[model samples]
Target: MSRSIDYGNLMHRAMRGLIQEVLADVADNGLPGNHHFFITFDTTHEDARLADWLRDRYPREMTVVLQHWFDNLVVGDDGFGISLNFGDSPERLFIPYDSILTFVDPSVEFGLRFETQDQESEAEDAEASPPLRARRDEPETEAEADAAGDEDEAQDAEVVQLDKFRK
Candidate 1:
């Protein structure tokens, strides 16, 4: 075995990149059809920013559905921002990608789970995107953001099983 290699970290980075690519595509064009995202993240993560009310509701982890109701979905180098409705009120959220735990596109049964520990402390690598900084004066309401797309036709997807990717 090559002691200098860190395949697990590389795999994690690659997986994150894939998610970013998908989100970037969605930003360009709205979710195609029948496709939506179920994203789970650490609600209490240092980089996560949510309305006080929402944070109080989900003190630890929370999953959000990116379907028909979200707006202002902006995918930045390090994180993403979106506006979700809370009892008819639109609340904005900013979540760093590092805080993400599970990302699933059920339409195709494609899912990825990331190991969350040490996520924030890890030094930035070439493969990772740069961090995003929020502008204090930016508008709260932005143009509606596009959703992730999915295919209407269902096809068998192969499952790749692996032990924990972290040592």
Candidate 2:
């Protein structure tokens, strides 16, 4: 039996490690300059933990922004925990690295996306395109900024896909 290397999974691990490092730095020194994250994760993942209402609202997936007001960001080897305000109510969440589907920093026009086995199979049959870039227009109000951080930008941002590195 021939054993083939799982390059895709290897790349995923590397990318997740990168996220861990970045979050670790942010946890120690806070987000630098305009760098902030728009992280989308699978709420249904067994290791994911969010408020009951949050899970109810975002049954399958949820996106959270790490910007001005988040608190208690603790990055662990396997996951991270954070407290964010939802309608003025602070909610804590624990998100496993494997559950993350997308991580984007619109300020830098950088992003990484991980596809699930199901999504990967579906992607194999469809034409590919770069991930949507989040808009960076300055928000007019604090309320707008908070809400806007979750919105996707119109312009195309450069996303590094692991598949491109495979032979």
Candidate 3:
């Protein structure tokens, strides 16, 4: 058998490390400048923790905005913990780094998306699965733009795909 370096997995680990470093900085110094995050993760992941209601509502995936009013940001080697408001109710969530799907910083037009082989196969089987590409389209409505923090309008956002580097 030919053994080769798993560059895709390596890149994924590096990207996740980058997110961890950035989150650690924000936990200590708060979000700098106009930077904020839209983090989407797999709600069904084994280590992912959230309110039962939230899981019911979000089912497979959930996207959380880390802007305005959030508290108790804690970064750890395996994952992070944060408290966010949902309909005036503050709920704490523990999101394992491995569960994350996409991390976006619309302020700087930057984004990262991670896909595992299992997820790719599942996506192919599921018709409603979201597109693999990170969308950089303009927001169609004011409400959407505000609620999503203009993520859809990030025209220059660079979405990194490790597959391109694979042999």
| The best candidate in terms of TM-score | 2
Residue pairs with backbone atoms closer than 3 Å in model 3 (clashes): none
User: What is the TM-score of each predicted model, taking all chains together?
Assistant: 0.67, 0.76, 0.74
Model 2, residue pairs in steric clash: 134-153, 135-153
Compose the digit string of candidate 1's lDDT tens values, residues 1-167: 55687666677777778778898888789787988887889998899999988889999988888888988989998888989887899989998887887777767666676755354345254334223211122211113112222322124558876765656
- Residues 1-167, candidate 3: write the lDDT tens digits: 99999776777788889899999999999999899888989999999999999999999999999989899999999999999999999999999999998888888777777786787678779743333444444233347658877344324457999999999
Candidate 2 RMSD computed on C-alpha atoms after optimal superposition onto the true structure: 7.6
Name the regions of candidate 2 deviating beyond 4 angstroms: 127-167
Q: Model 3 segments beyond 4 Å from truth?
A: 121-167
lDDT of 2 at 83: 96
Q: Residues 81-166, candidate 2, lDDT per residue (tens digit)? A: 99999989999999999999888787786777788888776666774432222233544334865888756334555899999899
Error of 3 at 126 (Å): 14
lDDT of 1: 0.72
Sorted on TM-score, highest at the top, how do the candidates line up? 2, 3, 1
